[model samples]
Target: MISRFSNVNRAYVNTVGISSVFNIGDSMQITPSIKVLAIQREQEIYYDEEGKFSQFPIFEEEIPQPVFYEQLTTNFFNKNPKINVDSISVTSISSSAILQIGSTKDIVCESRTKHIRQSKN
Candidate 1:
């Protein structure tokens, strides 16, 4: 197997990310798991000559359960036995991503994001 990478000036990997990989790489196994919950609340109040009123309610939500990595990995390998790649070339990889040059037994990446926005006036 031969891998040649050229003219790679700059690469940025953020949060849960993978960088660059050079030649003659073998058996690259990477497992990245991430869970994110983002909540935003906005409230606006208006006042007149008579009076002013503003009301905002509380927000409540339950978080989801985590993923089973062992089962996922087993299922992946069982489904795909022979995943062969002679050569690979890439410019960049970011945000729970993978950059593989050669052979690998297993590669599993999982990400879950939940966003909630509440506005009151």
Candidate 2:
């Protein structure tokens, strides 16, 4: 699981990379169900009292990201009738640092109204 922070110091989940599956002891194999979250930032366009259009930072609520699950192998389950399911091992890999977005232009605002409506609910 990798975490990223916005300019306002909001910590959000950026990515989840599963390199391998969890092994139930050295006998049985299992599947993985991963959940991820991400945030999309944008600018809100509105007219001021003076009738001049302006933009302001508006960040949408965190939403679920994509997760890829690998299929479990049936060979291991078939071989081991009495599976040793007491212990489990998780594989870990070196993760790279989080990259930050540069400026307000990077944030999209085309769907600002739609996001705002959703957030209220």
Whose lDDT is greatest here? Answer: 1
Model 2 residue 11 CA deviation (Å) reads 35
Residue-wise C-alpha lDDT for candidate 1, range 1-121, written one tens digit per residue: 2223333334343332433233234554666655555556675444354121122121223345567767432222234433355434455555456554445566666655556676865
Q: Give the per-residue lDDT of model 2 (tens digit) for 1-121.
A: 1112223223233343442222112222223322222223344444345221232233244445557798755432233333222322333321222122321212211222212221322
Poorly placed runs, candidate 1 (over 4 Å):
1-24, 43-92
Candidate 1 collision pairs: none
C-alpha positional error of residue 47 in candidate 1 after TM-score superposition, expressed in Å: 26
Minimum summed lDDT over a 10-residue window in model 1 is located at 50-59
Candidate 2 C-alpha error for residue 91, in Å:
17
TM-score of each: 0.39, 0.17
